[model samples]
Target: PGGVGRQLLQKPTPAPAQHPPVRYPLTGEPRILFWAQNFSVVQGSKWVDLTSQTFGAEASVDVSGSSWSSNDSRLVLKYANVLGSPLTATFHMTSRWFPVSGRDWFQLNRLELATPSARPTVFNASQVTAPSNYSWHCAHLSSLPGFGAGLRGHGPSPSWGVLLQDVQVPAGTPGFSPGSGRGSGREGLGGVLAGACLDEPFPPP
Candidate 1:
């Protein structure tokens, strides 16, 4: 009886190894070094400015508005000659959107970092927190009672409130561009970062 049972249940073959999807060209878990929610954080209508001065001493920003609703809630910030030193870093800002009443609105999400280094770093919104160095100043737009023609009170226009940078920050192609073919297994972020951000309805309401 024991021999007959063993013959009926043969040993199974081993399955091949499976790899998880890559999130950028880095190792370890993804983190959210910085983040900002919908334009709801900004009150003013005529203009809205969201500042990100929390990265480090070398990082400072002087902006008067944001690209929250326009340009898919994306922005590119480049710090040149970094204060007293001669270093630079580009912050590729992207967002996570959610559905609301058949429309989508921007949610504070991931940030992609690209330096002169060989690889790029990604900051997931769920992992990191606002650094101690972070500083922000949000104010509602004051009404200019009699500024423009037929102007009842100062407020943001339908499509003029949000402003995003029109620059492109591709994840980069592997083994093609400058300093591409490096890192673990020669894997490049070009395939990951260039188009990793999923597409959703734009001009989030």
Candidate 2:
């Protein structure tokens, strides 16, 4: 029988021409979080251009964004070259939402890659949204210890591959669970994508 899934699918909300400003993180300056640009052009995916950079010549994705929106779609950066021995990668993501008035904010969700590794491997990126009264998403793709595994750290990871996929937020409704991930168990915790890595030999700014 059709349930909430049916309702959700009935009339998907149209993405705004420009997402609400409140979706951007209020805290922290915007900066590049992680990137890897050593791959050659392979093909194009539904959203991104595929690359031929494999491990030792590996593929990658550069995560970037200062804000988020529920209306936004999930992001996934991937790499695959199963020519020899078993190689693997995983992506874990978390999101946070801050309100406009109070000093209150909370965790929304955390997602981890179930399978350790496989060809066409993918990482799950994240985004968020807040109530009309709120100001920003207050999220960034920080180099938090567990985030992106050891690939990223306390600061920007120079050449690591990653993607943002989940888009959960604190909607203040029943069944809308928070405190789902490692850092999200605490208030005022979450991260956002800052920027993608460079692929072309373009000049630096």
Candidate 3:
């Protein structure tokens, strides 16, 4: 008599642990448009002037893309040699959410200057010499505003610098040369130099 073979029941392997998506500080090739009525950069012990001559003068920097979440409150930008130095300059953005306004307002909290010889030298907002009238904005390729409209605004300016995340210039716009990392020789009034585009990834904090 042939013995009946019993079916072996094997336990199913548990599904891989589901993890939340990772969030970065920035995403897409966004251009950071910034301007200030008056500002300065600390060079050694003294402060170097980097201001705009006119009230509405501005500069921009095109950055590479990163994977991020919409809930992130921090954005970091890294540019190599854009400051005419071998080290890379990192801009750290800090934001606060306003439920009443249903928007997030951010500011340039600090600037990090990377050095080949040692760790980055941290520069706070005050150290950057940004005057009380300093203003800033951010633009993305997917959500660029009309030409010259990104910086146009009405009413009194905010006390803190605002990073307009949804403003940008098209690839072939005048005065903006993609992939060149250089401006159209139109430096801001106070030597606020334009930054070159760099494909660097800066993760969110």
Worst 10 residues of 3 by lDDT: 165-174
TM of each candidate vs. truth = 0.24, 0.21, 0.32
Candidates ranked by TM-score, best first? Answer: 3, 1, 2
Tens digits of lDDT, candidate 3, 70-184: 3322233333332354434444554446677665544445545454655555544421211111223122211013311222212332111212212111110122222112232
Selected candidate, larger lDDT, 2 vs 3: 3
In order, candidate lDDTs are: 0.27, 0.27, 0.30
Of models 2 and 3, which has the larger TM-score? 3
lDDT preference between candidates 1 and 3, better one: 3
Give the candidate number with the greatest TM-score: 3
What's the lDDT for candidate 2?
A: 0.27
Residue 41, candidate 1: C-alpha displacement in angstroms: 23
Report how far off residue 181 is in candidate 1 (Å): 47
Residues 1-205 of candidate 2: C-alpha lDDT, one tens digit per residue = 5697788778766632211111112235311111222212211222222323321223242223222333322222233332222223323323334455443322222222212332242322233223322212222232233333312222222222333222223322222222222223213232322332111111122
Candidate 1 residue 96 Cα shift, in angstroms, is 8.1
Q: Is candidate 1 or candidate 2 better by TM-score?
A: 1
